[model samples]
Target: MADHCNGSSHSSESFANIPPIKFTKLFINGNFVDSVSGKTFEAIDPRTGEAITLVSKGDKEDVDLAVKAARFAFDNGPWPRLSGSERGRILMKLADLIEENIEEIASLDAINGGKLFSLCKLIDIPAASMALRYYAGAADKIHGTVLKLSKGLQGYTLREPIGVVGAIIPWNFPTIMFFMKVAPALAAGCTIVVKPAEQTPLSALYYAHLAKLAGVPDGVLNVVNGYGETAGAAISSHMDIDKVSFTGSTEVGRKIMVAAATSNLKPVSLELGGKSPLLIFDDADVDEAANIAFNGMFFNKGEICVASSRVYVQEGIYDKIVDKLVEKAKALVVGDPFDPQVNQGPQTDKKQFEKILSYIEHGKREGATLLTGGKHIGQKGYYIQPTIFADVKNYGRGD
Candidate 1:
């Protein structure tokens, strides 16, 4: 692995403004350290096809360490023993820290995840803080229900923190997913062993630092960064993890379920992939529908799982909707995410870039007419123009 570098070689005016980054180690037991195996992996910058930094390459061994720490925290630490109001206060402090460091967090997300800097600054970072704060409020309110049993016998059930949680988040929305998983776990008073997707580990590590600063106790939260097969599988199958939460592809979700089932019969929650469709009726306003569809399908460079890639329109309004959508597609700016003028950025990595291009090729081969974009943007970077295919037919064989 290359030595830690600040990504200073990229000369884009926007890139220059980004804060320097140096923390690339795995966060475990409230400290950043190299992997036990002393291995590191290169984090690629999709915008420039250059190395951003070398992050610790965590595997099953690292997962075990993180999970053990979480288990210890849950079983013996003050975090779980603390009152809900105290926990809430701590989480609220974490939210404040997130807001205080929003710029650096948003910039890390933008540069590392190939996300729009403006969007990260304006939407993702704030949303993360909001999630933490909302969960913080909920922390004090975790309760139970009283039931009137049969024969006039009264009974009540109490809600308690389910031990350690293993959170496996995806690469598409790093900042949001981190809070979506971590905040709730923290609110519920469950210690966590987080396995951030390898592709976007910077913001998560930075978040861990901020979490420590906000007074999250050591061993209450741990982050192990690695590929899915190793760290993720370890978390899913670990006997100590009480719950496994995953957000990613269906294929991986299935594997997680099996691992959970086969190992300890642990409960699992999955937010897997979905096929989103946009339907427009003749009575709907054409321009309004066009803008919504464009935003729905093309936002985040079409990397969203719920991206509205499929469109169905009433016959009477088909031509008008397509014309407006096509015009909107053509107008989308594709370039560096940091550039305020550019609305689109490169694909998150080379694999996703090639995968999207392959799908575009398949769309053409399957007889869909390419209306606006059909090729890549520039010589460097994994960038494809905002592609639009019309006159499409669903010709594929189905299961």
Candidate 2:
């Protein structure tokens, strides 16, 4: 199916004019409230390595409240009793609402998560809205399977919504992850408590507000924003939750698996980090292939879990492709995300920035040839020069 998202058209007036942070409180029971401890954490702007706004910091106590709300909604609320078409209508309204406020929502992620403004507005946020609509259309189509039996004992299997769901999403693609996890659950009539990554919580909170405005019942969707060890760990182990869906690092995925098992043996869905690779043969178009390689390895500053970090080329085109990649890297623009000419934004945060630099140093020491740019671009933000390595040893991870 073709994507119906808005086209990429941004203005200097709008990109440069970012509005102030709108939603920062924990969303529960259809209301935005402060954390139990009244603690707040700074949501940083990677553009200048500074704090953009302070968001309510949720911990175990807050997570418990959010879970309770979701459980009650599942067990006693009107959402589960509503007709599937009614639920679908509400979800469709939510998607339309997201489009109505796309500018503000897109700007929030770009400012807080260090993603390119044009890309967020044009591609990511709009795609999220479309995803919601797609699931909305499927809401009414869920059904049970007919079965055959012998001896006049005929019956059919019934399908039902899973209970309360705990959704944990990474910061790399906040908008997409939010819908990818939450939409299907909502379509099936399951309430959810989401724990968005601390680095980028503003947009999730905004979406929560929009969901409520679109007539989704209170407690059907809740968002808790905080550090992973506290709020996230609580969600992973919460006994009342019927299922858990997580996306992030592999190490954390292990912890969630353990917690889900010991607490209640609840099933889990995890999307963990991995090194996906791309191989280019000699017959492919060198220029187009190089562009694909660059994008696969470096889109969103190479922050995606499926980023094609490892690339292999046939010996015949190896040198030629490397030359083309080098030229593209040199001409690439790196600066404020709002800049139309900027091809890449800063690392999501200082920790990510420093980690990439350390990895570059390690690669150099380990005998990988530094093929192109490998230096920090600016002193203000968490920026790094786009880098590539040649003559790399076939070193698997953790070797």
Candidate 3:
């Protein structure tokens, strides 16, 4: 299907004038190219349920090409061979570039990832820049300790780059996750191939472009966009990749581990799903606890992996806490992310939107009292009411 934008343009003059997303191709060796299979996927805007842009749909072939580039860069390119100070200089340049284009980058994330534009600008983009800067400083300070020998021989550990790294990121916090993975890896002189979530690939591609502009050598950084089943699996199993880092669901993390183990026993790292719980004690201040609980659940429309989904309250103050939380949820504004006044944005994509709604349905079916919201807010876009469930009990056995 052809990907195109629909609905009225939400680009307001008051905010940053974000240019339309133009670089939708896979980024490899500092160049943007279409997938070898000529496949493309529509990146739908969660705000209006319309196509934002078309991104190259990468597969195993694409992953192979990317991994090849990263491997070449690590083994023979100047990036890994450069002295720590030189690498730090380049990383610092990249950080400067990110700060220069922070607004535009944040805008891309807001529209593409369905995050609030203001929040992305105020928190997410700046946080990314901060992360890059922090790692840039570390590039020169990472040192190996000298060993003392009892005999005549003297030896020292050498801190070296771990060849090629494959990074797979999740969609809930695209901009933040991109920097979290890319910054430290770059600072450590490692070449990497990144697979941004298909739901939000714009910012990652744009960042790659900026990296190239900031003097990062060709093949040092690459990005492939596609579903997890194909490109993600390829990265996890690639023979040349020294390590695979994944941030997503536990189920997918297990698959990555299996692929890594079965393929070549390459090391794998995972930051998986969270089932965070918020507990309120009898002596706690109900108002403060309610505020924290509200932010924990409703922030980012509860798409965050660490969203406090389960809430427990002491019986003495349970009613008061629930009442306060319900009141706060009712007051949150949900609408276009571009609107500065809108505090809650739509869910990131259709699948997540539907998944959240289904959970709400199951909550009701399971006899939990729906205290506030349990439905979509508008006809267009993927906005759900801030929902709260009370009187929930664990029905299954615990391990």
Candidate 4:
């Protein structure tokens, strides 16, 4: 791997301005309140495996209160009663507010989620702002269908907001996931209760403050920070919730599906975890192909849901591509995300870090040839090498 260099290459701004933790309690009914049980959980920084702050641990009672607030907002508040153009204006203002504090928000995710600081600042924050603006533009354009019957009868359908939404976002991409789920629901005039992942709850809480500043009505947007078993379970099975949106493991998605079905039959939108495949033909340039495959596999420490983890190459150029890939993998710098020279940072949290190591061990025990990397790298944080295996009997699974 390349040697660590100075931090002044890309970002001219100083990392000295990393903001202090301002909000940690559950945001409900346009107020920051403690959980009903007065329980709190640690928000650990994956960079050092240390507690950054103690966040309120919300349970069923907290979820119920948030739901009650959301129901009241949706049923009687001016948020749902407002015109689409008015809603669109408010969302646009929210987007602007996000851009204003983009750097502070980006730093929060980098510390809380172990993501590369430059990536968070340059890509994720901008994408989040654009997502809000994108959905805001659609607010006024939501429409229903008007049909003419065979007998010249007029028929029309109305497009109404789906009531309260429960958003459970994963830790990998906190800011993007928050905006992706939230902007649309707000555009549709729906009240929502958000349950951010425990590992990366800071950014979500900061956003709740910004949403209020941008004129989002109280109870229209509520954020409950806690574990999935308590808060997320309540959201999925709650009777007042109209729908549940989750982005995480497939295992949890299945459970959420069952819970939604057994309850009031509320709908759900799930973005489950899985990997994809990458192919290289003989006609392609071998070096370029290797570079592409390296990025596809190792981006975001290979934590992406649809990452290109499997590779199928044409035999004519297979050997050359493998050699190039091994070379590139070794040269990848794994270190602190704040260091601009580092190509990859630590994993999101300890559970994911050890989980990856176990998978590597499984591949070794199963007799897959270890091609390049398959070991831990750093001492203080959760850092794993960019692992690659070859000649697998299956997709790295043989029993």
Where is model 3 more than 4 Å wrong at Cα?
A: 1-18, 396-399
Residue 227, candidate 4: Cα error in Å is 0.9
For each candidate, what is the lDDT?
0.87, 0.89, 0.87, 0.88
Clashes of each: 0, 0, 0, 0
Best by lDDT: 2
Reference-based lDDT, residue 36, model 2: 100
Write down the TM-score of every candidate.
0.95, 0.95, 0.94, 0.94
lDDT of 1 by residue, 96-121 (tens): 98888888887888788889988998
Give the 10-residue window scoring lowest on summed lDDT in candidate 2.
1-10
Model 2 Cα lDDT, one tens digit per residue, 1-399: 110111122222224789878899999999999999999999999988889789999999999999999999999999988888999999999999999998889889888998988899899988999999999999899988877787877789877889999999998999999999999999999999999999899999999999999999999999999999999999999999999999999999999999999999999999999989999999999989999998998899899998988999999999999898877777777777887767877789989999999999999999999987677765477777778899999866796
Candidate 4 lDDT over 241-288, as tens digits, reads 999999999999999999999999999999999868898999998878
CA deviation > 4 Å runs, candidate 4: 1-16, 395-399
Better of 3 and 4 by lDDT: 4
